[model samples]
Target: MSLAALINQLADEDTSALKTLSLVIDWVRPRPQETIASTLTRMEQLEAALTESLDVHLAVSSRLQSWLDNAQFFQLLSGLGLYSRRGFFKEISERLYERVNPAPADRNNVKDVLFLVFNRKGDDAWIHEVPDEALLKLLGTLWHFSPPALERTRIRVCTQILNAIEMLSIWVAAEELEPNILRLNPRVVDRESAFVALQRELAAFVQSYVRGLQDEDEIHLDHDHALVLIEQCRDEIARLQRRSVTAGSTMALTHLLERLSQTLTRIEHLLDILDPADKEKRTRRSIELFKTLVQASAERHGVRTLWRDNLRLMSRSVAENASDHGEHYIAGSRREYLAMLASGAGGGLIIAFMALIKIQILQLGLGKGVETLWVSLNYGLGFMLIHMLHCTVATKQPAMTAASIAEKVEQGEHGRANARKLAELLVRVGRTQFVAILGNVAVALTVAFAIGWCYTRLEGVPLISTNRYDYMLAGIHPWQSLALMYAAIAGVWLFVSGLVAGYFDNRAAYLDLAGRLRQHPLLRRLLPLTLREKFASYVDEHYGALISNFVFGVLLGVTGYIGYLSGLPIDIRHVAFSSADVGYAMSVFIPGVEAFAMFTGFALLIGGVNLVVSFTLALNVALRARGTRISSFPKLIRAWFQVVRENPLALLYPPADPRPEPLPDNHPHPEAAEAGQPPSDVTDSSPSTEGNR
Candidate 1:
């Protein structure tokens, strides 16, 4: 029952080493709320008990040595350290398969013993907490008590290490030959790559080591050249990773590079274990290798971790595209701020027309499904037209701007100056968003009211019936309706649309859609070369925005229908549309000033919810994708207050001062002028001019 009793029983009986080791591990394992010191103390007690007497030490040591002699260490030493032999997709599938249907255990295999010993979920959590010193001490105690492994066992381990190195080297070389990798470094294909040279060197080293072993000669194996090649391979992988950021990357390319990196690291660890020059160093390395094995074995069936690991790079790629699109939503100057207002007003005019169409569609006694389809078409086509005309939607700005803000946050150093810069950027974004919302609501309401007045004059009747007007009024009542909740739903759609835009942008780059379009056979036959090229260029620039706008419109239109089918209260209430509805309601019947104020107040509240929810979600995702955090929220808040205190109206409008002019292309850099030479770096600073060049 106790550890001392268990050791005594093992000494008396010829128990299997697996059962004995499992019992020992169970006794020494840390309990819940137990500290590492406690676990170390328990390990010390077990060591004392194991070395209590010569007879007991010999008996237990003999059993452990026997287990070592018979058990296959090759798979544990080689396979556990390396990834699955299968490709990335197959490896993922295999992990999932193993989770569902685990293979039968083999007592002869060390892997089975590992699985049995560290079988519980979250085993890696505590195992990782244990310091290297504690692990090394535990390993040292075990090695001291147990007799030395048989000479055959030692040779077999070395052979397995060599085999793993050879296998990993070949895999690395093959991965380097992948098309995505070659695209980044084409020279790798033309010559003997580091991976290939490593493979060749490994083969020679293995042959020499094997020959020396067979002849019983004191052989000195020089792994310097092989290690140098491994470093070179790693440098190439790093270079490819850096290049992928600019050239763009796909899941497959990311997975290949990840696998190559892991394989190369595993080879280095294996080589360390195989070093015979220093037993003490080898023992320490072996403990580290054992810890890696334990952690890997514990997480072997973790599907979520695998998915997260695989998606991290791709998510970053998507976020990068979103951030690029987001920069336009942030206005850095007065001209851009005014341009955003005009854009928002243009979008609002279309939205007012769209609202009238939605009302007409609902008035038709068409079936629910047909009505929903027509409404969706109106919203989708209207939004697409707005995008085509370079108009801005107020609600859509937050999702885009949040990503841009996150990019700035990621670029800033963690200090007071950086926080102040971010605060200034935030103020700019706030003013831009405020003007856009003001434009959208002001223009949509006016247009809708004018349209309603014209219809009433022409037909001698209000555009909306009294009952319908009352219903629209009640729908937007902040206290009496679910207007804010519905607005939040619309906010969620805005966030999703941002991601949709990013995904399409990433897909276009990955697939070279622009190039494909330019080369299309149909385009070649139907249009002139210049026209075809322009069309392709336009698509390349606006593909994501076009798709995302349509999708967002559909999402907004279909929410009420989904709620109707599901018998739920799900729906959306966008600020621009709500303002248009109120305008139509006002045209039918002029409510009291207090009632008008209430309608306007609720519309503004709805807009606030939409902005908050969308920006929060988008900022969270962007930060995670960039692997960064806002340096200090308190500092940022203080900086914001300081800016607001200096000028309360800064959040509504840009400064009166004009934007500073850029230096002419001929203007010399200060350093260059002092040196009396033309500046080599002088080039167009404008984005359009740079792109054209």
Candidate 2:
């Protein structure tokens, strides 16, 4: 039937007909088959007819005004053609609560009437196929025009309005939209629509929204997929920009271009962060971004969003454990070099003793479990003492030092000249490592040889049998045994120790462990204030390193047993300990100079593998943890070569000038001491050895 006929037939007293017409308006659903022009034409006609019909009814009867007074009538009118005048409709919302305050029952009565008008009909009401055009017109006329009290209306009213808006969102053109109009388009949908302009706008809005989506919920996107999607957006923006120049810049075109530029900038920023080739730059940005995301979680979830935010708390606490570890890497002068050397020497002395203990333990003829325990105790207690005494373990430097360097790099230390800076840093590290290793191996070999010589002199027999001495010598030879593979395994253990140190450090800081320990009731009651405070402070500073060192000892102790269980020949060969083993072999067994030289040479080579493989792995992890990446190996190698050619001694000796390296401006770590300070220690002893106790 014609819209005019429907409007003309509606009478003030014919409430059923008026209600039916309201239902007809609410039920209008848009269909894809209809053209835009035809839809708009129908809408314009229906609105004019409905408005005129409502005006005539208002003029003819007091009943129309009474119905307008009823809240239910106003709600139904909102679904029909009630308040087309935007200004007056908006005022109804402002004064609605005031009106409802005086007689809330009037509002409830209105709701009751609405319930009967719509709920009683149910799905049968939806069967009436109201024209999409008419529904669109009615929705546009009444949208957001409801009285404030109607805000609490039932879901049926909300659903009708939402359906209409969703349908309208599909038809509305971004170019034609005014900011004043309420548009519910989410701006997050994939837009491959025919409307090129709207597609760009939608993509831009979605991208902007995505950057802040933790406020909504988490979203994880594939790195490659995000890049491809961004590339498509870039192309579309360029195409739109070119067209805007030819079409002449309208206000809409200018706004669209601005959004496109902003979106392109955001896409580029994300791309820079994700690029694998740009490791240094990527890591710095990623660290900052991760930190920001973590901060936002607090803001969005309000500090302890779920379960008092234990994860973040624990990470921060664990990070604090690295403070002491970090300080072990920074060297500024000759004094620091000697300190590091002394620390290494001290560690080597203990490692030599540990090797002697291991050999004695192996001769006990105990089961593997008992053997593992004794060996662990021998290594763990020895290393714990080394750490307490502040001695050095050469391979452990990479993991802790990486975090320190990453912090420095993150403090605006990157750009075109980053390669040179990294080269300088690497040189310092190389020299420090060289001296430490020298101190360790030199002392350990000397100590082991002296111990073996003294023992043989006292007992009038060799410390190890001739057969076992040959086996130790042959084990160091790469082709005769798995020395290289075992060295690599040691390297892996070194890397793990670094990670363990970092994790515990973070945990300490996050949990405020020192303060918590100080606050313990027993400690407060039993200890003096000074002692309690000191104890807590020590734990806060040294707990992670202590735990990591002990764990590392256990790991080293179990390697052979694990490999044996798995029917493998896995073992570990560390440089300092191996050199000491070779020294013992030379003292007890080897008679020929050629044989002694080969064993010594092979032991040194095994040590080299252990240091290189472990340090390299540790460096990689540290970079990743800090969201930093090393430049390609070729680039780093070239840089190293350039530094070497300029000054060959830099990696072996301290420079004459010896400027103190500055701490990073934003360094959060608070490690207790510097390189020249008392050195920390861990054992590098292998798990097995020679003769009976």
Candidate 3:
């Protein structure tokens, strides 16, 4: 296994190169670290020399292809060696690609190119659209591919076939596989065949072969504990044994194929069951090897189709469950409760307007406040608009259970636009309507202000006035003439808040109901139907955690709030004030109307706000969780492979983790016999019912 030897030997006769490499792989394809390193360095130098001479990737590639064509050698390389998957893939990627893409126009050559990766476990690594993708990249009518040469094609193809016996073994194993033998996947179909011919072929070969080997002692070694390992020497060994052969003066390809035919027969003869180790250990190693091959070989050499098929399975599984959102995602808004808030504010705005208008009409008749009313309306409208904006951008309060519903639902290519539209819709319907109502609720106060001012002016004294306003703070009362001002403000606050809260709750409920109608598939069958099953599976998957998290937070928040309130010992009370308290100094005040208006407004506002907050929070949580059906499925399955992939464990098993990868690109799929075909249908084990909303 000298560097100079690999280069010199691979440099000549494609057919001879394949045979030599096959021998190198079987007898000395560097498996140990020291051997592998030296081999890589030598290969690198060869590649450098070939590049300097001109373009020799194809020449060198055909030589490597010759090795893959053999069964024993292909299996040894694809299935063994290396802690790093990436490194292994890099080593053989270029050569594999060249083997597959030898010549764009040669049907035999093109088919040969495709065969190089048919059974390899590197799909998650390479080959976007199969078949034509390996031979030519299509863009509209234009196609891209490298030039082809017939140099050593005959000899190379022959040697490649002889060398590929091991690969073929794996290929056969991969092709006729029992669905049950795959990853702990529930989506696998039972022995049903999609292609009749293929199915028959597999049945005939696998069954007959298994039965035929029953009498052979060397058929398997550790049938109970390991994969059967076996060897099959090529027919070339026979010709070499005979000593009546021509080494160089004949059609090399024909001889190579002859060797391939005989070697596979020997492999069948020598079948031995391979040993299996630790349960987790075997799977871990298999997956790790698969991943390494995928990475290094993906870009350069098209990845194995089966690997891509698996990805297609996993990807479709994700897409199926993730299409919709949950009930908890919908949040009730204080803004949507417009009608109720207006019950309070609408009265106030009218009152304020009328009184000011009356004063202005009287002044114009006598001549005197046009500019003043204009400025006041401007200020009031400005404040109202500002408040609405603030609510739209404001962070959720403590009781809010929903987390980023707007963000999650609005993902994908046009995610931003959809989100923007939803936000805008919310603002117009939810916040704007409510604000308008609140504006009306406070209108009467303005009216009271104008009238009181007029009355004071008539008496040559200040009418309704206050030193300062700490609206939420209770301190000294308002001025003597304006005692009604306090009542008016209280009226507005109580009524507006109550209305807003109620509407928030109502809207949350409605939106949640409406969201369900948007499901990808409607449940129109019995309880145990697939859709329901999928739904239940996902819900049940995370039910424990979701419940636990909810319960824990509820208890914590309640305990904390109660404790804080208990710490306060200050007296809290509200004093009742009437028109009599002010006497005639607040002369314009009618006690009955003032009290009636204030109490009614206060009652409605308080109730509304409470209703809105509670409703909004609950619905918000539900809406956010509605679409995640995976929670209904088997939770352990989600994370099984994931756990196997981290650190030390990753060295041995497939990652049984549940981290969902990003979705595929948004490009349109081509119209093929099976366009956008999702692999095996798997039912999730999550519970369909949800408590998130």
Model 2 spans > 4 angstroms off: 1-327, 407-417, 590-594, 632-635, 658-693
Candidate 1 lDDT score at position 161: 73
lDDT of all predictions: 0.80, 0.58, 0.33
Which residue pairs collide, candidate 1? none
The C-alpha TM-scores of every prediction are: 0.82, 0.51, 0.22
| Superior candidate under lDDT, 1 versus 3 | 1
Candidate 1, lDDT over the whole model: 0.80
Could you tell which candidate, 1 or 3, scores higher by TM-score?
A: 1
Lowest lDDT 10-residue stretch of candidate 3: 572-581
Better of 2 and 3 by TM-score: 2
Can you tell me which runs of candidate 3 are displaced by over 4 Å? 1-71, 76-191, 195-693
lDDT per residue, candidate 3, 463-579, as tens digits?
Answer: 422321222112213332222333333333322222233233222332332234324254534444566656654443333223322332233223323434577322111111121
Cand. 3 Cα-lDDT: 0.33
Candidate whose TM-score is highest = 1
List model 2 lDDT by residue over 537-653, tens digit each.
Answer: 999888778877887788888998898789999988888778888888777854688876777678778778877876676555545433446546577678778988898977787
**Model 3 error, position 42 (Å):** 13
